[model samples]
Target: MTTVPRSLDEIIASADALADRFEAYEPADADRDSVDPTTALWLAASRRAAAERDLAAAVVEARRAGVPWKVVGELVGTSGEAARQRYGRHAAR
Candidate 1:
């Protein structure tokens, strides 16, 4: 079996940068209907941000699925107690 690569903060940062770049470089005529390229880029960046959120949620779910807090925290660059305080509430419901 292969383990999937998961880096929530990195993914989120990348997505935000992409979105910011797309917005910054958008053409002046990139209104709701003028040119389609900017619109497409905007959509793609939005999708990336959404995907990042989904992945973070999945990581949280994986923790809820009985994966150890220490391991999850290590993967996310935090301590087990930190992970518990930050994410344990999700598993409460």
Candidate 2:
């Protein structure tokens, strides 16, 4: 699989910049209709994808640290079998 072109630090900086912009935003009445539905959906979907990747990576780290799958499942809000099925391959040696 391909990796992100940006370094982790650069990616974090970009996220921080986005957060700053969002915090500074003050929408006008006219701006209410400015958001495109497709863009909004794409943004949410993209963020969800990123979150999933982060979760998977964390699972790998936890497994490497000798954390049990049962605990991982609880933390991820699922059963041990479910968590194993989902992220076990990534954590496999």
Candidate 3:
């Protein structure tokens, strides 16, 4: 199977799934500072998923509009080279 998802919707769905999984596994501690390592990892994973979804959507829209990957990377605060390295494979499929 391809590592890249087919659409923005799929990316968002993956993010939602990560968020749900985080919620399901989160510790019910009253103090936010008291979260354990596992819980913290879940939180981080949830955040990463959300960020990935947003970035994927932007890349998809930009590609559809004929915006170059380098320009898109610059807009996102990364090198054009890096953006292509990270997202180009997805666009290919």
* Highest-lDDT candidate: 2
Ranking by lDDT: 2, 3, 1
The sequence of per-residue lDDT tens digits that candidate 3 reaches over residues 1-93 is: 746667999999888988999888855567756879998999999999999988887788888889998898999889989998888876666
Model 2 Cα lDDT, one tens digit per residue, 1-93:
845548889889878988999999999998987779999999899999999999999999999999999999999999988999999999995
Worst 10 residues of 3 by lDDT: 26-35
TM-score of each: 0.40, 0.65, 0.56
Model 3 segments beyond 4 Å from truth?
Answer: 1-33
What TM-score, to 2 decimals, does candidate 3 have? 0.56
**Which residue pairs overlap in candidate 3's backbone?**
none
User: CA lDDT of 27 in candidate 1?
Assistant: 52
By summed lDDT, the worst window of 10 consecutive residues in model 1 runs over 26-35
lDDT of 1 by residue, 1-93 (tens): 844436998778778987999988855554645658887899899999997677568667877688898887887789978877877776465
Model 1 vs. true fold: TM: 0.40
